[model samples]
Target: MVSAVITAAGLNRRMREDLLSKGMTIEHKLIMDLKGKPVIIRTIENVLESGVKNCVVVLGHYSEEINSVLKDFPDERVKIIYNHDLDCELSETLLNGVKNIEYGLCLCVAADQPTVTYNTMAKLIENAINYENPENIVSILARKETGFLESAEGLGMPFVCHSKLLLNYLPEHKDNLNPILREMISNDVVFYGTPAINELELVNINRYNDYLYIKNKF
Candidate 1:
């Protein structure tokens, strides 16, 4: 079974400042409303609907508030882990979730990426399970720009990865996750990219404007 890990630990400094300055009381990007539901809630809902058997949600900065919302999920397989350091790097949560995942592969999904649909997730999981090579990293290429949904192959989230392989590289790793991922790619850990995806599915919420654009269009 391919499990899922939802990263929602970031303080979202940029989005927080922008919202506060604009006189909006939004606490975090994940808490912002998307089609009348919290972004994280929408993300979790879609993931669960995709039939992911196990899920781990990692929360930091606003753990209390976020935990309250997660209580709504009825799935017994969902696990919640708290990251003590609010200023900690993303790798911390990745490691924390890895310890709890009992599966071979993990879906490293982001809480702010609410547009990732059940269909996309299901396809990626199926691909990971049936992949010929155990060393290959499975992923979905989503929108990185306003381009064709058919041709755009921008590297993206909800990435299907070898849990143990990544966990092995966690020790001595520092700062952000990109460097380690790049290092793995350089070491020939090829990413098994899934089929083309809709540009909307890759709209990551980093800034207030990003939230606005997705809320308006999608």
Candidate 2:
């Protein structure tokens, strides 16, 4: 069964401070309302709707607040894990979720991306499962350019791969999976990209302005 690992443990240093300055009390971007649902909730629901067998969410920083909202979340497929290191990098948070998954294949998603669609998620999983190599990493690509999949910076989450690949390639110290993914691509590890149907689904909320942009657009 393919499971999903969503990283929601960000410190949100920039987003929190920016929103506070704007006189908004939102503690983190994950809790921000996007089209009537919280960002993280939307992300989780979208992943589940894509037909993953189960999901693991790694929480840190504002874990209590994050957990409070999810306390009554009825979905039995969603599991919550905690990372005590509030200052851990994004890669580490993702790794924490990866380590806890019980499935052979894993889909990596960012909780801040409320706009991500179930259609795009299902497409990514379909591509990964169709590939010959179980080790192949399948990611959603924003552009149709050929070289976009070659670099980690161009590779964003909502990607699918074997759980083993993440256990071996994810670096604990890096802010993101980009550096290690770049190294893996250089080593000829099979990394493929499926073109996103709507690029807006790939947009992530990082700062106050980003939240505003999403709210305004969607």
Candidate 3:
């Protein structure tokens, strides 16, 4: 069995401030509309349409609002878990979802990335299964993602790995995955794959402009 883990616990501080300054009143970025549909729904649709059976969504920092959005999706494979402390870091969100999963392999992704497609996710899962080591994480490499150093190795999420591989390195607090990724790099266990996906799907949206660009393109 394989489960898809989605982390959407971010405060969306940048996105919120950007919208407020522009005279908009959006609070929950994950539930914010992405080309008519909510962002979180669009992201999960990608996973479900990709032929993944099980999905686990970790919610925090305004769980009620996100829950309302999730109710629209009637998939039995979709399950929700809550983080009582909104301050829990992103890594914990990843851990929260995977720890409850009984699957040997899981696909991890960020809910904020709406353009991430099912094709990319499916390819990553295949890569993980064929990896030389079960512990090695199969991650996708993006060429056009912004808001980070261009030199950064992999895009933030959409990684495939065994549950045990992550538990061994997961810390209690990690807003970013760099530390864990660095640890894997030092041990030479990270496998990067360039799947045949549209570069737009890998674009990471943190601000209003990003949303507009994605909206206009797709």
Per-residue lDDT tens digits for candidate 2, residues 1-218, read 79999999878889978978889776778887888888889999999998899999999988998998887889999999999687888888888898898758888899987777888788778877877886665555444443236555556676888888788777545667777677777877767776666657757899988888888987
How well does each candidate superpose onto the true structure, as a TM-score? 0.88, 0.91, 0.89
Instruction: For candidate 3, write residues 1-218 as lDDT tens digits.
Output: 56888888888888888999999888677877777888889999888876666998989887888899897688898998888678878888888888878758888889987787888788777776776776665455445442212233544587777888778777544657766766665666665655446767767778888777887886
What is the C-alpha lDDT profile of model 1 across 24-134, one tens digit per residue?
Answer: 887777877789888998999888887677889998988887777788778788899987667777888778887889858788888998888888888777766776775
Instruction: State each model's C-alpha RMSD to the native.
Output: 3.7, 2.0, 3.5
The candidate that achieves the highest lDDT relative to the unseen native structure: 2
Of candidate 2, the 10-residue stretch with the lowest lDDT total is 139-148
How does model 3 score by TM-score?
A: 0.89
lDDT of each: 0.76, 0.80, 0.76
* Candidate numbers sorted by TM-score from highest down: 2, 3, 1
Candidate 1: list runs displaced more than 4 Å. Answer: 142-156
